[model samples]
Target: MQMLMYQECIDACFDCMVACNSCYDACLKEDDVKMMADCIRTDRECADICALAIKAMQSNSPFAKQICALCAEICEACGEECQKHSHHDHCRRCAEACFRCAEVCRRMAA
Candidate 1:
């Protein structure tokens, strides 16, 4: 696939990656780190996948579509986890970015 065609998805993935990283850092600093365990884990995982997806798309990898599908799934899961802690600004922003990334990834995968 042409990189141009995947620009939107790439941008979304980048945004999600940043949001997830920020959320992960913020969660670790929260008073109740134990309570933020799931969110922290999900954020890390989501950020990793988003980074991978960006690389795959940038390289025009043959598995780009498949990678995107998995990225979407992980993004959705991360979004749900972040949404649970949405009262926190970082979590809320992360959730929004994850959901947007998931949508963009789904379209790219299709």
Candidate 2:
């Protein structure tokens, strides 16, 4: 059961990474990219953190739980930031993905 939970968490991390990357790329294409600067930065940070959390979990490290907890927080913040621009379809989708990933990470952390 623990192993299965780890796998699910890893999957969620990957999904969040993809979503973050996509959102970042889309943001760069916007006419006013400066407006999304913070969102872009958060997306990159969240993606990196999620990937690190997945690696830690896969290694069965004792710190994995703590890393996952941090990852969940970052993911939630990123999601909220992304949701601010619901006018963009990509941002909306990315926010949803981040929210889902955060929930999964929270469960795994616990």
Question: Per-prediction TM-score, please?
Answer: 0.98, 0.95
Per-residue lDDT of candidate 1, residues 1-110 (tens digit): 59889999999999999999999999999999999999999999999999999999999999999999999999999999999999999999999999999999999999
**Residue 65 alpha-carbon offset, candidate 2, angstroms:** 0.4
Please give, for residues 37-72, the per-residue lDDT of candidate 2 as tens digits: 989999999999988998898888899999999999
Which parts of model 2 have CA positions greater than 4 angstroms off? Answer: none
Kindly provide the TM-score of model 2 when superposed on the true structure, using C-alpha atoms. Answer: 0.95
- Looking at candidate 1, what is the lDDT of residue 103? 98
Top TM-score: which candidate number? 1
RMSD of each: 0.9, 1.1
Q: Lowest summed-lDDT stretch of 10 residues in model 2?
A: 1-10
Give the Cα error of residue 64 in candidate 1, in Å: 0.3
